[model samples]
Target: MPGERKAETMEEVDLLVCGAGAGGMTAALVAALEGLNVVLAEKTAQVGGTTSTSGGTTWVPGTHLSEQAGVPDKVEDARAFLESVVANRGGARLREAFLASGRAAIEELDRKTDVKFVAAAAHPDYLDGPGAAYGGRALGPVMFDGKLLGREDFDRVRPPRREFMGLGGMMVGRNELGALLSPFASLANLRSTLGIVGGYVLDRVSYKRGTRLLMGNALVARLLYSLRKAKVPVLFESGVRELMIEDGRVVGAVLEGPTGTRRIRARKGVVLATGGICWNRKIRERLFPAGTRDYALGPQTNTGDGADVAMAVGARFDDGGDSPALWMPCSSYTRPDGSLAVWPHIILDRAKPGLFAVDAKGKRFVNEANSYHDFAMGQIATGAIPAHLVCDAAFMRRYGMGMILPGAGNLAAMLKAGYVIEAKTLAELAGRLGCDAKVLAETVEAYNRSASTGVDEAFGRGSSVVNRFNGDAEAGGSNPCLGPVGAGPYYAMAVRPADLASSAGLAGDEFGRVLNEEGEPIAGLYACGNDLASIFRGTYPGPGTTIGPAMVFGWRVAKHAAGKLTDQPETVSGVMTDERTKNATL
Candidate 1:
C-alpha cells in the first residue's frame, strides 16, 4: 500500500491549512509569522469565502482599538451580558477563552501583519444586555486599495456580491452608502462620491472590477496581501480529499488540485477552516428545523467536506446552539440575466420609521427595529413563512425596500418582476398580498394610533439605543423608528429567513483542537471558522460575531501549533519569532 501511494507527488510543510476564508487565512498567516512553513489550500479559484461578500465587521471586545476610541467596556460586564442572553450549553469555557485571548490575537495581528482594523465609533452589540456597549466592540476593516496587490494577485481575491455593488461591480461600504445615494446633498458628500466613482472608472480600464475594496472585500484583500508578503503559498482550486491519520494522529492530507492528486505531509498540524456545512443538503436536512427552506448566503462550494472528513475520523459535532444557524431575512428577485438575486435586509430600511413586518394574515409579528437574527427568529416562532414588509409611498421613496433604491430608480421593473407589490389602497394591498382586508385595515389603524403617540404598545420598536441609531434622525417624529404610514400607494415586499452562517459544527477545545468522541483532542488536528462550533452556542451577541471568533481561534490554533501559546496581553513585534511569549501583567 505504501509503494502504491508513493506514485503521487509528496510535499512537506509545517502547517497545512485547508480553506482560504478569513479564518484559514488567519491561521496560515499567523503560522508563517511564527516561523512555521505554512501552506493554504482553497477549494475555489479565489480567496475569501462568505466574508468577501459580507459587511466585514469583527466583534472582539476590550482591544486596543476600543481603548483608543474611549469605548467603556468591562470583561465582567461582557460576561454578564453573555450569561444573561446565551443559553447554558456548556460553551462557557470556549467563550471565556475567546474573551481572554481576543486582545492578544488582535494586537499580534496588528503588529505582525497587514490586517488592520478600526473600532466602529457607534456599532452597538446586537442585544442591549448588562455588558452591552453603544460602540467600540465591533471593528471594521479599513478601506484597501486593490491596486496595492497588483491586478493579477488582486483577481485571485473574491469580489463582493453583485447585488451589493453599483455600476456593475463597484463595491460600497455601509457608511459611504448615504453619500453614494445623495452625492449632491453636501459638498463633502459630492467629493466622496466623485472620488469613489472616479476610482471605479479608472479601475475598469485595467481590472475586471473596481479595485477600490471596502468592508469584507478590504479585509480579505488585506489578508491576502499579507500572505503574499510572508511568501506563503496559497494553492487555489485545490481541495483536501482525505486526512492522513497515523496511529491516531493526523499526519497530512491527500489533496486533489488542478495539477492532479498529491500527498502533503504536515510536520506540525492541519487546521480545517472550510466554510462549514452551509450547502450540504443531507446534513442541513438533519440539523435544520422542519419546514425551513433551503436557502443560505454562503458559497455553494461549502458542502461540509471538512466536517465529513473530520467526522469520519472520529470527531463529534456540537449541534446544541440556541438556534442551529445564524439567520438573516432576505428577499429574492430574478435578475435580467435569469439569475436569482438574494438581498439580505440588513439595516437599510426595516428599522426606519413608517415600516412594519406582517405575516400572511396581515398582523404584525415582530419589532421592525430588532436585530436581523431576532427578526428571523420572530419569523420562525410565529410561522411567518414569507413575511411582508409594509410601508407607504413616502417611506419607500425615502428608504429603499429590498433591492429597490431610495429614489425608486427601477420601481416599475421591480414590480414587473414580482419583487414588489404596490396597490392604491390598504384593502387592495391586502388583497394582492393574500391577507384579510379587514384585519390589514385594523392593523394599520392600530399602528397609526401608536405612531401618532410615538409609542409602540405591542412591541417597543425604537426604545433601544441600537434601534434609534438605524432610524432616520431627520424623521419628524418622537420615535425615529415609528411613523404613520402615509395615505394611499402602499408597498410591500416579501422576505424569508435564510442562514447567514452555520453555528452547529465540529466540537473543538478552547485551544482550537478538534475533539474526538471521547472528548479528547485529536492530535495534530485543529478546526476554526464555521467548522468549529460557535462559542456562544448559536446566539448572536454583536456585529461580526462569527468572523470575530473565527479569527481569534484561528490565531490560537497557529500559536498552539508553533509552541508559542501565551495568555498574556503584552504587545509583541516582528515576524518569525521563535521564542515562547512570556506571560505579562494585563
Candidate 2:
C-alpha cells in the first residue's frame, strides 16, 4: 500500500529487517554498522530466534578461525567442497559468491560488533564422499553473559530460555557440556563440582550473586549483551505481517506489534530473515507428512512469516526437492502443557553401538551416526515411513536408553504407547512392528556380526563420533557390528524422523534477492536463512551450515541494498513487471 495511500506520518529507515534470528540480526548489525538507518523486528519477544536455541556454530571455511587454529583451508577449497556437495543442482556462480563473501562478512562482524568467533576443530564437512575438509572450518560464537546487557535491555529482548527440550535453555557446545559432565566423572569432576558449589555458597553468603547457570542460555546472554552495547534497535514482539511495495521495489513493511500496527518504510529495502516453517503444522504436514507430528525442535515463531509476507508481495518460491524434515526421536512423556519433549543425546547415544535404524520394512538405510541432516534425508531416500531404532539389551544398558534419568518413566510410557516396543526375540519384535520376521532377524544378525567386529559393513556405522557416541562401546568381535541381542528383551523405538527445521522456501541469489519462476530477481524483496532454499540445496555440508549461509546472505542482501554490489554484473534479469508491482502495493 504505497501509492494508494498518502505517505502520512511514516517512519523511514535505510533497512527494515524482519525477524531477529541470526540472519536478521546479522543483517541489521551490518547495515547499522555501515552507518545506515536500520530497524529490526521480531515476532517473539526475543532478539535471538533459532540461533539462540542452536549449537551456535557457523560453517565458514578458510576463515580466521580455521587459520588461527592451524587448519589448512583456502577460498578455493571451500568452493570445491560446496561444488562437490551441491553438484550441478546449485549454480556454481551462487556457490562462488557465498564462498567469496563468507569470510569478509564474518570478519566485518568480528571487527565492528560484539560478535566473536571461535574455531570448532572437531566439526567436519558433511560429505565424506569426496573433496571434504577434515576439520577447523566451523566457527562458534564465544560465550557472553546476559547480565552484561543489564535489566532493561534483557527485558526488552527475550532469550531462548524456554525452548530447550527438557533442559530449559539452548544447546551448549562440547566445552560447556564437558564442564557439566566433568563434575560427575572422577576426582577432577568431583573437585570441579565442589569448587562450583563452594563458590555458589560463598556468593550466597555474601549476597553477591544469584544462582549459577550454564549451556545455551549463557551463550545467548552474551550475544544479547553485545547487541545492547551496539545500540541496535531490536523491536521485540513485533511481527512483519506484510511487505510495502513502491515502484516494483520492496520499500518497507507493515509490522504488527503488541501496541498496534505500524508501517515501517525502508529507504533501502526489507530483509526477510524470519526463519523457516518448522512450527506450522499445515506446512510441516504438506512437506513432511510422516514426521510432522514428531518434528518439534524449532522455534515457535519460525512459522514462515517472512516467506509468507514475501509471497504476498509477488515473490516466487522453490522447494529444492521432496526432502523430508530432519527428525530425532523424542521422549514420549507429555508435559503438564501437553508438549512432547525430545532427548537429542539419546538418539546420538543409541545409534552409536550395533543398533541400527530401519524403515517400516525393517531394512537398514543410512549410516546411523551421521549428522541429523544426513540421517533425515537418508530416511526419506530409503522410503522409510516412521523408522525404528532397534537395539539389544547391552546397547540399552550401556547408553541408559532414552533420557538420562528421572525421565526413564517417559521411555516406559513411550513403549506402552506403541511409540517404543520391547521383545525377547527378533521375530517377536518384527511381529509387533508388522514387518517380516525373517527379514528383521537377518537384519539384526548381520548388524550384530558387524558390531562385534568393530566394523559396520552394511551402512558404515563407525564413521563419526556423532554415530559412535551412541553405539555399544564395549561390544567385542573384530567388526564390532555383531553385538548379538541374544541377551533377550531387545528394544525398539518407533522413531518419527523429525527436523530441527524445514529447509525449503523462496529461492534467492547469493545476494539474497528472491527469484521468480524465470530465475530472475524480484527487486525490492530479499530473503535469507531458512526462508530461502538452503544454499547447500538439501544436503547439510557441515555444522552451522544453515547459520553460516544465513549470515552470509543476510550480509549480502544488506550490502546489495546499500549498492555495494554495483561492481558485480547482474547475473540474471529482473522478472517483476510494472503492472504487477503496482497491483501488489494496491
Which candidate comes out best when scored by TM-score?
Answer: 1
lDDT string for model 1 (214-265, tens) is 8999999999999999999999889888888777888888888999987898
The global C-alpha lDDT for each of the candidates, from Candidate 1 onward, is 0.86, 0.65
For every model in order, what is the number of clashing pairs? Answer: 0, 33
In candidate 2, position 133 carries an lDDT of: 71
Q: For candidate 2, write residues 1-586 as lDDT tens digits.
A: 3223334435888888888777777777777766788888888876667676566678777777788778756766776667676776755565666776777877777777777778766666656645467667778777554446655554544444242322333233443344444466677767765665565555354332322333334434554555566677778788988787666677788888999888988877888888777776666667665545645677766777876777776667666554534344443444458766555532345455546787788888887677766776676666675677787766665544554332243456556554457888888989988999999988877876775666777777766544543344555444333355556687776555566655678878767888866777877778877787776666677777777877787787777777766444333332222331222112
Number of the top lDDT candidate: 1
Q: At residue 309, what lDDT does model 1 achieve?
A: 82
Instruction: Write down the TM-score of every candidate.
Output: 0.95, 0.85
Which runs of model 2 end up more than 4 angstroms from their true locations?
A: 1-9, 155-185, 195-222, 280-286, 289-296, 322-332, 345-347, 405-420, 453-455, 463-486, 570-586
